[model samples]
Target chain A: MADTSHGAAPGAESAPGMPQLDFSTFPNQIFWLVVTLVILYLILSRVALPRIATVLAERQGAIQRDLDKAEELKRTAQDAEDAYNKALADARSQASEIVAEAKADIQKDLDKAIAKADAEIAAKAAESEKAIQAIRDSAAKSVAEVAQTATADIVNAVMPNAADAKSIKAAVTARLKG
Target chain B: MATEEAGNGFNIHPMDQFEIKSLFGGGPIEWYSFTNATLWMGFAILAVVLLLVVGTRKRAIVPSRSQSVAEMMYGFIHKMIEDVAGKEGLKFFPYIFTLFIFILVSNFLGLLPTSFTTTSHIAVTAMLAMAVFVAVTVLGFYKNGMKFLGLFWVSSAPLALRPILAVIELISYFVRPVSHSIRLAGNVMAGHAVIKVFAGFAGALGVWAALPILSITAVYGLEVLVAGIQAYVFTILTCVYLNDALHPSH
Candidate 1:
């Protein structure tokens, strides 16, 4: 009994090949494990995990917000461009309209100037015809007077007793008429 | 075995490092005694706190490197929980996050020479697994009441086979915790053990020890991957279990 007990005691006291199989230290191992694990869990849930989650959340929120802002800004830029293009188109149309109006105005002024020039030319032509007619009438009267004087003078010189002044003048006038 | 001799003047004790003793010199370990496990766990917690709290103290919009790392870890697990278990599962984010970070930091720390691998112990992993199992089970019951048992009832199966399918499902349901815990502990322990064995060989075959040493380096790199992957697997599984608990129809 003594030898068996001694053998058993040594077997029990000496460590097992696998320390895990040794029941003696299981409690200590488990106890610390629990303690440390509890502490870690607390830290995780309360401190570590929350901090990480917050950072991640903040990053995501910031990214999404920035993206939305960028989208809004992009839309604004597009709208601005559209507005600019519209304004440009409006300005271009207005400019074209103004050009058309100016062209019409210039054409109207040119036509008026042309009409005034034509009237001036027509009036000058009428005046010029009157001056020519006046000259022609003066020449015809002078010619009639010259022919009577000449006829009277010629009859008196060449045929002294042939005819009287009145007869001669009448003869000359008839001949000129003929 | 503590040490082995391979027909030469070399002695190796690959398993000695796993021994649990009082961190404050050797003595009988009481139930509440501080140990290497506790020390490493404390370190793991400190690492987590430092990364999560202090690193993000400034909370700069343009984060610093440490803050980026903290945020990356935060987002990684956050997305994972949401992806695997949906938005409702985010309610358990703290618990799952704690498990993941603790396991992850512990695994990486374990890679350090002479450092204790807290997760390599069945006790530690089993504790985590049981906690998940119990939480999910309670949540399942609370959410679905007796309908939670419908998880094991195969309605699509033939009428004659439904009961057998239900039994199988029930068995698997109960086996979740066992498999969950063993998967982590076994993988961690095996990797560490293999490294230790190679180390032992390197010491035994002094001149030709370069081969084992090179292998240890390779396995160490693999262990780093395993560490991260195991942590991910654990958290994802937790999320899956939470999913089933929340919706226990199938």
Candidate 2:
């Protein structure tokens, strides 16, 4: 390859033995390389790096905030549940108190009604006893009257001249006593 | 020259693609001559701006697909520097990131057909490696003072073997930039050159071109992997070197 290149192009040839070994192009490559590196470094440090750092930090902060909000909401829900349970317990105790008060009132009313009925029954029994005593007394009196009359009639029929109302009455009364 | 031999026999000029020609017209390449190298470097810059700047313009908390991609790249390099170079090295994050994005974009761009691979040139890789080397050395002295020399001295070895170990360490330390620069250039150049050679075979071989085409396809896939891996390797090595400068204990 060297002999062929030498025989073909004599001096100031375009293609060398190896293009990489070409000293003439080194300055240009190095110059552009330095320029490129400087440009890249400036852009990266100034604009790109800081921007990415900020974005990453912002994402992290946003995630943290979301988690904190979730925790707060959970705590609020728990507080509400506790309050509801407390209210439920309070209402139950109040209902039981109302029921006890109603039971006491009904018991008082029942006792009063029973006492009044007993008093009425006792008064009616006393009145009936008194009337019964009065009827018995009337019946005894009539019996005595009838007996006296019968005896007097009998005597008058037997002995007409000796029959007197006062005498007969006295005799019948003495015989009855004996 | 290979074009001159095309009429006679098989024509294969794999190195021709690497030639640095003036973009405007044919002339002696001045230091400021806008060549293909300048144009491709400009493309790399445009790619960086589009991805890191325009893509992240929304700055969405829940990132869009392109925005997420940009963030992922940022996080990957950020974490890498933190892990390898320690927290103090985060100060150089933009510098290291610039190197990484440039090399990465340039490698992928070079994989395109008829594109000139800027990183395949020693001139470009050497500048990158030397920049890292000089910066790291200066940082080592600035941070550690004269104690930076302790990085070469093997305190763990036997008393008698310390000198030999120190000499070896010194030599290895000096060779870092050379190996660093050459490794990237060599890998990129080798892959592109191999594909070009295979492509040349596919062109020359009349009826049996299928075999070379198959080889080209397989190699093309490998080259894609190499493109990403080489950029990663370069960045990670830079971090490791920076770590040595920052710590310099061993």
Candidate 3:
């Protein structure tokens, strides 16, 4: 190390008016300080600053991208919620319509069955009336024939206006007795 | 209190006397002579160089103990700069950290027996301080241009107070190196002188004097603390000056 002894550092020591500026003496100290400063400035402005700025920029950009993705996911979730609600509404209306349709179909089927039963009953009643009418006519004709015969017999026997109604009377009595 | 009493009583050199010397060579090139203070500076530089060289040689994500210790120191200083001066202002971190480490190492190294205290010498401290002063002034103007001189006369002054304020500001600004250098040198020199005096007292104690030794031990601890603090103050002040340069209105 270079001796800086005779030039004792002035502070609490050293007399006033001693030469303060001696470039010839402390050249190396000054030189080293300058070198340090220049090198530090270069490193800061060039190498370190650029790398740090880039890292920070990339970090911020990544954050922004993530935010965009999150926003998109949120929108998709909102859409899904809306669709779910809409589907639920559709299901509710469809269920009620289906219930109403079933009721209407049942009513239609009942009306049709009632109409068919009425037509069948009317046809069967008309056939029964016709059979009863034919039976009544046959019964009336038989009664009339019996009365006519009886009257004829009575006339012939009693008046005897012609050859013996006695034979006819006997026939009638026999008929009656047998 | 005990340490102070011991320190006050013992004196290798009279407390009132201040002596400065340059040993080994003399004459025209006397400034090139080897010095006790320069030895301290050398020790400081050696510590910094060794630390950086060994610390960085085996860089790892999950660091080994030595590397981690180095990283912790780096991180600590980095955070200090970022916290005090913005990350935008962090362009000055390396220099700030270097200044701090060098000063701190020098102060601590000086505490050893048969060692020198470089910062106690005004020329060394003054040179460091002058460099900071020059850098601050130049950087203020360079970064902000001629308008940077407004740091003295502008901002919070009333129109009438401008001249007076300018005078005061100039005086204060010029005094920056003086106060900075004086504060460091004075503290170290005064503390070392006190410790030497107390150490002498310990030797004078007779067979029945265990108390002086204990007090000497206590002064040693306090001196260690002061050494670290003085270095810290010097470094932080440098950063503060840099901050003012970066943001002159501040």
Query: What are the TM-scores, per candidate, against the unseen true structure?
Result: 0.85, 0.82, 0.56
lDDT of each: 0.87, 0.90, 0.65
Quote the RMSD, in angstroms, for model 3. Answer: 10.3
Chain A TM-scores of all predicted models: 0.66, 0.62, 0.51
- Across all models, the iRMS values in order are 1.4, 1.2, 7.9
lDDT of 2 by residue, B58-166 (tens): 9999998878988998999999999999999999999999999999999999999999899999999999999999999999999999999999998888999999999
State the lDDT of candidate 3 residue by residue for B49-153, as single tens digits: 555545444444445665555555656666777776667567777667666666677778878876766566666678889988998889989998977788788
Tell the DockQ for candidate 3.
Answer: 0.04
DockQ of each: 0.53, 0.53, 0.04
User: Among all windows of ten consecutive residues in candidate 3 chain B, which has the lowest summed lDDT?
Assistant: B13-22
| Per-prediction fnat | 0.72, 0.78, 0.03
Report the Cα lDDT for candidate 1: 0.87
Q: Pick the candidate with the highest TM-score.
A: 1
The residue pairs that clash in candidate 2, if any, are none
Q: A105, model 1: CA deviation in Å?
A: 2.1
- Candidate 3 lDDT over A41-81, as tens digits, reads 45434544343344445556878999999999999999999
Models, CA RMSD each: 4.3, 5.3, 10.3
* TM-score between model 2 and native: 0.82
